[model samples]
Target chain A: MADEVILLDFPLSAFGMRVRIALAEKGVKYEYREEADFMKRIKSDLLLKMNPVHKKIPVLIHNGKPVCESLIIVQYIDEVWKDKSPWLPSDPYQRAQARFWTDFADKKIYGDSRSVWSTKGEEREAFLENFKVLEAELGDKPFFVSDTFGFADIALVTFYGWFYSIKTFGQFSIEAECPTIVAWAKRCMQRESIARTLPD
Target chain B: MADEVILLDFPLSAFGMRVRIALAEKGVKYEYREEADFMKRIKSDLLLKMNPVHKKIPVLIHNGKPVCESLIIVQYIDEVWKDKSPWLPSDPYQRAQARFWTDFADKKIYGDSRSVWSTKGEEREAFLENFKVLEAELGDKPFFVSDTFGFADIALVTFYGWFYSIKTFGQFSIEAECPTIVAWAKRCMQRESIARTLPD
Candidate 1:
C-alpha cells in the first residue's frame, strides 16, 4: 500500500516549516493542505478533526494517523523515514542532549517573537539572553549537536523566518545579538532543504 | 568499568518521582542524593554544576555526565536501560502518540497545582476538562496505549501524589470528576516500581 501523508498547515507558520524541512530532509513526499482561515483564528474542520485537542495546525497525517505538535511531528518524520539523514543521534546520551536543546527552544525561545509581534503589534523586546546561551552552546561547532545539522538545528533554525519581523519590531538584530547563532543558522540554510522551506 | 549512576533529587517533587519510578522499573541501582534545601529553592553545588542550563533538581547522572529535565531524564533512562520494562512503546506511530499525550500533560496539567498552591494559597480550580479528555482516551483499557502501563502513565501517575492537594484547594475530588483517570492511577500504583516511588 502506498503511504498517504498529508500536512494541514498555513504558510508562514514556523512550526509547520519544521515539518517541511524535516520532510524535505527525508525526501518524503506528502500532500500539503493549507488552512485558509488559520490567520483569522478560524480552523479548518480537517485540522480540528486531525488535532482535536490543540486545534492547531501543522498536523502530519501519515497513512491517516495525525501527529500533532511541531517537534513531535518532526521526530515522527525522523523515525518513519530513517533511511535518510538522521535527525536524532545514534547514542542514547547524545539523543537525550539533542532532545533537551530542542525541547528548550520549543518551551522558551520559539513562541516569544510570534506572540510579541501578533499581540502588541510592533511593541517588542528581544530575549537576547536565550540567544546568547544558544551561542555559547554552539561555540565553534559547525552545528548545534556538532557537525551534523540535525534535530536541534531544525527546531531553532525554522524560527529564522520570524527573525526579520523580530528585528523590525524589537529593533535589535539577531546577527548582532548572537552572531554565532546566525552563523549556525546560515550554515543550516545552505542545505537546500532548509533553505528552500524557510520563509524569507 | 561498572556504571556509576546517581540521581540528584528532592523527595516530594512530582518530576523527581518520575525519575525514581523509571529507575526502579528498569531495576537499575543508583545512588540517590537528596537535595535538602530544594523546598527553599536553594540549589546545591552538585545540582548547579550538573544541570548548569536549567539549574533545576532531578538531574540524572549516568556515569560522569548529567541529563536534565524530567521527561528528558525519563527518556534517557528508557534508552540507556532497554533491557527491562520499557517506558516508551516500540512502534514509531505508537511512540509518537505516547509522546503527544505526555507532552500535553507536561504543558497544560503538570505545573498548575504547584504554582496555584505556592502563590495563591487554596485559590484554585481543577482543569477537569483535561482530565476528562484523558479519561475518554483511556476508555476501557487497563492503561493508556493499551494493556502495558508505559510512557503516558509514567507522566500522569506521578501527579497522583498531588491529586489530594488539588482536591483540597479546588474543592473537587478527581474520583468524582474523573473516576476513570483516578482508577487508572490506582491500577498503575499496583506496579512495584510506581508503588514504591510515588509519595503520599
Candidate 2:
C-alpha cells in the first residue's frame, strides 16, 4: 500500500509485538524492519540515531516521524485511526479506569516485573513486592476491566509473553499466584492478532 | 459556576499539582477538595466509592465521574474542553513527542528520581544513572520540548517541587548536579498557577 505505516521493530520484542498486533487488529498494512540487537552491536543505523536514550526496538514510524514507547505508540495509533475497535472507552470515568489499569500494567506489572532479570538482592526483592501489589490489586477480577479486551489487556499480554519466554524466577508458573490474571492473559492471546504476534 | 468541574486532590501530591496547573491554564472554574492523608488511608466513604484500587489523590470528578491518574485527568480535561489553553500540541508528530516527554518525565524523572529518597546504595546509584540519562537527553534545551512549555514542562515542574520539598534527599541538590534542570524548574515556578499552589 502506498500509505502503509512503517513499523521499525523486531519480531521477538514484546514491545514490537504489541504494535504489530494493534496494526493487525485495525487491519492496517505496514512495512516491518527487523532491528538487530545492540548487544551484538548490529542494530540499524536509523534506530541508533532515532532512539539514543533506550536504543530499544518497537519504534513506530508513522508518516516518517518515529514514535517510541509501546504504550504511547499504541495510544497514538488509536487516536489517529479513531473508532476502529475503540481501544479507549468513551465514558471519561471508564476511560480513566482503563488508563489507570494501563498505567498499572505498564508501571507496576511490566515495569517492576522486570526485576526477575536483575542480578538479584534488594532489587529483585523490591520487584517481587511490586509484583505482589499487582496480584493483590487483581483479586478475582476476570480482567482489569469489567468485560473487555482493551488497553490494559494489550499491555498485560505483552508482559505475559515475556514471563513465559524468560522461564526464570519460577514465573513460568503463573497459575498458582495469579490465576485470574493468567486466565485473562490466555483469553487475550486467543485472538488471532495476539496469537500471531506473540514471541516464541 | 454550577456546572463547573471538580478536582479532588492535595498540594503535597505532585500528581494533584499537574491537574491544578492544567485547570489554571485552561482558566476553567472548579472546586478543589483537599483530600486528607487520613482520608486517603482510611478511604473515606466518598473516595472509596469513587476510586477503589490505588486509592490515591489527584482524582478529578468532572460532572460527577471520577478520573484518577493525574496525566489521564489532564488529557480528559483537555479533550472535554478544548477551546482554551491546549494541553497537547497540534501536529501529530509533535503531539506524540509531547506525550513521549510527559511519559518520560513521569517514568524516568519522577519515578526513577524517587530512588534518591532512599538511603544511598544501589538504588541511589540507579537514580543517579537515570538523572544522567535525563541530562544527556536534554542537553541545552530550556524546555523538554523545543522552546514552548507543553505537557512535559507541566510534568517536570511537579517533580522539581517534590524534590525541593522532600528532606529525605536534601543532600543531593539539583542546583549542584543538574543546573539546566534546576534553572528550568525555576522558570516554571514563575508561572502563576505553580507559584499559587505551593504547599503551606
Candidate 3:
C-alpha cells in the first residue's frame, strides 16, 4: 500500500521548515498544505481534528494519524522513510547528543531568536553569546555531529532565516562573531533540502 | 566486564526523578550521586565535565559517556539496556505520540507545576485546566499511551511530587478536578520504580 502523508504547515515557521527539510532530504512525497490563515488564529478543521492537543502546524498526518511537534515530526519522517540516510545518528550516545542539541535549539535558541532583533545592549549580547555556545558545539566539525550532515544540522540550520533577520534588523553580522557557525550553516545550505526551505 | 553506570541526581528534582524511575524500571544498578550543593549553585566537577552544555543533572554516564535531558536519557536507558522491557513504544506513530506528550510535559507541565503552587484565582484555575488536558489524553487508558507503563508515564508521574505540593499550597484537590489522572498516578505509584522516587 502506498503511504499517504500530509503536512499542515505555515511557511515562515522554523519548526515547519524543520519538517520540510527532513521530508525533502528523505525524498518523501507529501501533501504540503499551508495554513494560510494561521497567523490570523484561524485553523482548519482538519488541523484541529488531526492535532487536537496543540492545534498547531506543522502536523504530519500519515495514513490519518497525526504527529504533532516539529522535532517529533522530523523523527517520524526519518523513521518511516528508511531508504535514505537517517536524519538522526545511528549510535545511541551520538543519537542522544543529537537530540540534546536539537532540544537546546528548540528550548534555548528558539526563544532567544524571537527577541534578539528587538532588544538592545546586554540582552542582545547574551543572545549572541548563546550562538557562540552553539558555535563551540559545532567546533571544527563540518556538521554538529562529527562530519555527518543529519538531525542536528537540520534542526539548527532552519534558523538561518531567523539569523538573517537578526543580522538585517540590527545591521550587525553573526558571521563576524561566529565565523565557524556561519560557515557550517553555509555548508548545510549547500544541500538541496535546506536551500529550498529558505529560497529567497 | 560489568557495565559502569552512574546517575548525577538531586532528590527534589522532577527531571532527575524521571531518570531515577527509568533506571529503577530497568533495574540497572549504578552509583546515584546527589547534587547536594546544586541549589547553592555549587556543582560537582564531574557533572560540569559530563554535561558541559547545560551543566545539569541527571546525567547518565554509562561506560564514561554522558547523556543529558530527562526524556533523551530515558530513551537512552531504554535503548542501552537490552534485557529490560522497553520504555518507549515500538511503533513509529506511537513513539512519536509518546515523544510529543513527554515534550509537552517538559515544556508546558514542568513550567505550570512551578507556579501552580503559589498562584491564585484564574492562574490557579488555568493551571488545573492543564492537568485536565492531560487527563483527557489519558481517558480510560491505564497509562498515557495505553495499558503499558512506560516513557509517557515516567515523564508525567514524577510530577506527582509537585502535585502534592500544589494541593498543599493551594489548599485544594487536584484529584477532585482530575480523578482519572489521579487514578492513573495511583496505578503508576504501585510500581517499585515510582514508589521509590516519592517514598514520603
Which CAPRI category fits model 2? acceptable
Once model 2 is optimally superposed onto the true structure by TM-score, how far is the C-alpha of residue A154 displaced, in angstroms? 2.1
> What alpha-carbon RMSD in Å does predicted model 1 have with respect to the real structure?
3.0
Which runs in model 2 stand beyond 4 Å of their true positions? A1-6, A36-46, A81-86, A114-149, A160-187, B1-6, B29-31, B36-49, B115-148, B162-183
Span of ten consecutive residues with least summed lDDT in model 2 chain B: B162-171
Candidate that scores best on DockQ? 3
Question: What are the per-model C-alpha RMSD values against the true structure?
Answer: 3.0, 5.2, 1.8
Alpha-carbon shift of residue A124 in model 3 (angstroms) = 1.2
Query: lDDT per residue, candidate 1, B1-200, as tens digits?
Result: 98999999998888998899999988889999985465587789989899877788899998899999999999998888988868777789898989998998897677454454544434434366677788899999998874798888888898888788766875567788788888898999889988988875
DockQ, candidate 3, vs. native dimer: 0.84
Local distance difference test values of all predictions, in order: 0.83, 0.73, 0.83
| Docking quality band of candidate 1, CAPRI definitions | high
How high is each candidate's TM-score? 0.93, 0.75, 0.95
Off by over 4 Å in 1: A36-38, A114-126, B36-38, B114-126
Q: What is the lDDT of residue A179 in candidate 2?
A: 66
Q: For candidate 3, lDDT tens digit of each residue in A72-156?
A: 9888888888888786776888888898888888777886765586556777787788898998888888898757898888888
